[model samples]
Target: MITLYGSPLSGNTHKVRMALAFLGLPWDERLTDAAARQSDAFAALTPMRQIPLFVDGGLTLRDSQAILAYLAARYRPGDWDGHTPEERSAIALWLSHAANEIANGPAALRLARRFGLAIPEDHAAAVTARFLPVIEAHLERRDWLAGDRLTIADLAASPYLALMEDAGIDPADWPAIHGWTRRIAALPAFPAIPGWPGEGAN
Candidate 1:
């Protein structure tokens, strides 16, 4: 059995939840906050005290990117990670984008606006402005981010971008992105991100 630790509304946590769904893995979660993370039980699990923490058997992992990569490697193997060096490299690139650009841009925007986290709105907005166009143009001609087929790379990048609304950015501005998220949501067993467009309307 797999165990995940994080908040239900967190985009990062949602990424792992989606992966578990796609992989048909049974998992349970412990919702966390600063209080929960600082507690002895959570500290004994991971000193990092950050989420989404993943525990499978005796193995424990932190950081969503690391967890996503591990899930693909251990469970999906060549299927989700990729088949060739080029494909793997491309997937890695997108994962990095998801962790950095997507996280800093749209995700941070959500943190600031929705949760009032004191993040710099101007900086995040600038990053978001640049990010949306790059992704919009890239996705204009492609269905998936990394390769011709679906992979964890696609999963890695979609959450924050799809949750652009929570960032105060209109999803209608990027039709391709909207369509891409819709495609991802339509996949079998894909879990819903709390505020994604058309969520629960399916």
Candidate 2:
């Protein structure tokens, strides 16, 4: 069985949870204890002490994007991932955007609002102002982020972007993004991300 360690409300953790649910994999969820995360046992797994630590047999993985990629590679194979080199690269590019822009933008805004972090509002807004339109324009022409099918890209990027409203960004301003969230929400086995609920795959 798979074992996932993280907080339920974490967007990073939600990515892993969504991938596992999509693959129909049964896994155990272990809530992280910030204090325990400093222990030697946890340090042995990941020196970063990052949450959303994934354990599958002997494999221990950190980083939400890496965890999602591993799940697709091991379970869905060529199906959930892309088919060609270009397609795979396209997916990877979006995954990078997820780790960078999305994380610094919407996700950071969230940390400031929900968790009382010290993130700068202007910096987060600047990041969102710059990248969100790119996503909006990209989604304006395509249903999915990369290629023509569902890939790790969508799973990696959607969680935080879907929380635009909570991040002080208006969702209605980006109709395409709103529609995209609904489409992803409609994916099979898509799990609700705490405050964000799912309408299930149509």
Predict model 2's lDDT versus the native.
0.86
In the range 38-78, model 2's lDDT, one tens digit per residue, is: 98999988989988899989989999999988888988777
Top candidate, metric TM-score: 1
- Tens-digit lDDT track for model 1 on 1-202? 8889989888888889999998898999888986998899888988888889999888999888889899899898888998899989989999988988898899999999889899878998888888789889999999999777778888889988888888888888889999899888888897866787654442
lDDT, model 1: 0.87
Candidate 1 lowest-lDDT run of ten: 193-202
Candidate 1, residue 8: the lDDT equals 80
**Candidate 1 Cα outliers beyond 4 Å, as residue runs:** 199-202
Q: Give the Cα-based TM-score of candidate 2 against the true structure.
A: 0.93
Q: For candidate 1, report its TM-score.
A: 0.94
Residue 202 local lDDT, model 2: 20
Clashes of each: 0, 1
